[model samples]
Target: MTLYYAPRTVSAAVAIALNEVGAPYETVKIDFASSDQTKPGYHKVNPKGRVPALITDRGVLTETSALLDYVAALYPKARLVPDDPFQAAQMRSVMTYLASTWHINHAMGGRGARWAYQQSSFDDLKSKVTENITANCRYFEDEVVQGPFVLGNQFTLADAYFYTVTTWLPSDGVDIADFPHLHAYQQRMQARASVQKAQSDGFF
Candidate 1:
């Protein structure tokens, strides 16, 4: 397998999952600093010109959630995902929220062109992006996270997904100290071997 990724981005979530699976693979860095991802060469790998595109035995798989799910499925013994149906559904819910709400809020700080083209609209979004992320984080820190992990004591795929999102907080103008539980959650994730490996691999 070959994984296309960008450092310090949500693409790291896929790297963390790949680390957990202990799979043999290669990484094709999509250097956003040089606009490499926007080039036609990369568009062939992911027509959307996004990172986190995985070359699998079957075909190329894009999207963070899909790549994570595919890795978990390919290596069931790694136990990246929960076995129980309800727990699995809860995991999906958390991932969906992070992708749909939390991530979008963070993106608003700099990528508002996705919604409106006006510079004023972009500035408006930048002003409130931090607050939006914090509010949604409050929901997750309180309403979700029932135990040590999202699925009680068991570590699920959601942990990797959520942890990756948390990485953007500090850069998103969020002082994680305001979210103690979430801060501790970040610490726990950082202590994991997989996360440590991702760090060493420069996935950050």
Candidate 2:
């Protein structure tokens, strides 16, 4: 398996999941700083031109949630997803929300061009990034984070997914310290070997 990723991005979550699964894979760095992801070479791997594209014997997989779940499915022993139907649904729900909402809020802090073409419009959107991310952080602090992880003691793919977004909060003008549960959750996540490995390898 080969994972295409960029540093300090959600792509690191896939690497962490692969580590958790004890999967050996090669890393292909797509340096977004140089616009590498937009090049034609990478388009062959992911037309969407995003990070966390996984190339396996079967095929290339894009999208953070898909690749994360794929790793979990490939190695069931990792138990990245729950076995019970309801629990599994809950896990997916959180991951989906992260992709659909939290991640979007994080992206607004920098990638405004993905949404707006006009420079003034892009600036307006970018200006709201910190506020939007703060709102999302408040939601997670008050409603989402359940316990030690997204699903209490169980560490699922959702935790990995959510952890990636929390990394953006400080830059998004969110005082993580204000959210006691989330702050503690971040500490616990940082202590995980998988996360530590991903951070070290990702140069973050």
Candidate 3:
């Protein structure tokens, strides 16, 4: 069993994926409004204070990418990660794109550490983020996924990453309707029973 400390954004995907696997776990919800992640108490669990920190028998693991990968490994029977080398690479690629391009660029009301959040640099940073994510979305539309899941028909951790990042578009003012396949994919994921349960539990 593990305890996951999560926030309202990207953590949603991690929580949902874990639920999908029927993994036994508890959650500690952190309020980004008042808590300082770098403070001593939170830092003790994860020096970074980022949400989606996994406290396991081994230790606490931070970073959404690492956490999602660990979840797949911890529950192999869930088939949330690919077994083949190439497929695994593709899975990682999708997650990397989501983390590096989407989360940092568009989060925190466009006022986060990822890029210069001031007005002078905000437009430029936003443009870059939009371009990069749109390109990544196109790549996914063209090749990364087959049917609904990123790893072909098999639902993998990549789907969790996809669902998480895609959820931000509405607030970020990014239009997804242009990417029909990606939009459809999001719909498909949201329709899952496990995803519904996770949403009910407080993911949204």
Candidate 4:
């Protein structure tokens, strides 16, 4: 498998999952800094022109949640997902929230161009990022996070997904220190070997 990713983006979640599964895969860096993702060459890999596109023997996969799910499915022995159906659904709920809500909020800060045409509108979206993301942080702290991990004790794919989103908090102007549980959760995730390996491999 070959994973196309950009550093400091949600793509790191996929890398972390792949590492957790001990999967043998190579990474191809998509340099967002140079607008590499927008080029026609990358569009062939992911027409969406985004990072985190994985090339498997079957085909290419995109979207953070889908790729994470695929990795977990390919290596069930890694137990990245819960065996219980209800628990698995709960994990999906969190991952969905991260992709649909939390990540959108963070993107508004720098990716306002995707949503608005006017400069003022862009500023408006950027201004709301901190408040929106902080609210998300609060939700995770009080409701979503079950302790030690998102599902309590057993580390699920949601942990990798959530950890990737939390990485944008400080840059989004929301201090992680303000949310103690999430702050600790980030610390716990950082201590994991998968996360460490991802960082070492420059998937960060």
For every model shown, what is its TM-score relative to the native structure?
A: 0.96, 0.96, 0.86, 0.98
Expressed as tens digits, the lDDT of each residue in 70-150 for candidate 3 is 888888999888888888898898788778766765663465445564676666666566666677677778977787687
What are the per-residue Cα lDDT tens digits for candidate 2 across 1-204? 999998888888898899888999999999888999999999999999988899999999999999999999999998999899998999998889899987887787688889888888877887888788878778888888898889887889998888888887777888889888899999999999999998889625
Residue pairs of candidate 2 with colliding backbone atoms: none
Where is model 1 more than 4 Å wrong at Cα? none
Cα displacement (Å) at residue 93, model 2: 0.8
**Per-residue lDDT for 28-85 in model 4, tens only?**
9988889999999999999999989999999999999999999999999999999999
lDDT of prediction 1 = 0.88
Q: Which sections of candidate 2 miss by over 4 Å? A: none
Worst 10 residues of 1 by lDDT: 145-154
Higher lDDT: candidate 1 or 3? 1
Q: Which candidate number has the best TM-score?
A: 4
For candidate 1, the TM-score is 0.96
User: What residue pairs clash in candidate 3, if any at all?
Assistant: none
How well does candidate 3 match the true structure in TM-score terms? Answer: 0.86
Index of the highest-lDDT prediction: 4
Q: How would you encode candidate 1's per-residue C-alpha lDDT over 1-204 as one tens digit per residue?
A: 998999988888888888888988899888988989889999999989878899998999988899899999999999988888988888999998888888888989878988898999999999998788889888978899776777789887888888888888887888888988888888898999999998988888
CA lDDT, every prediction?
Answer: 0.88, 0.88, 0.77, 0.93
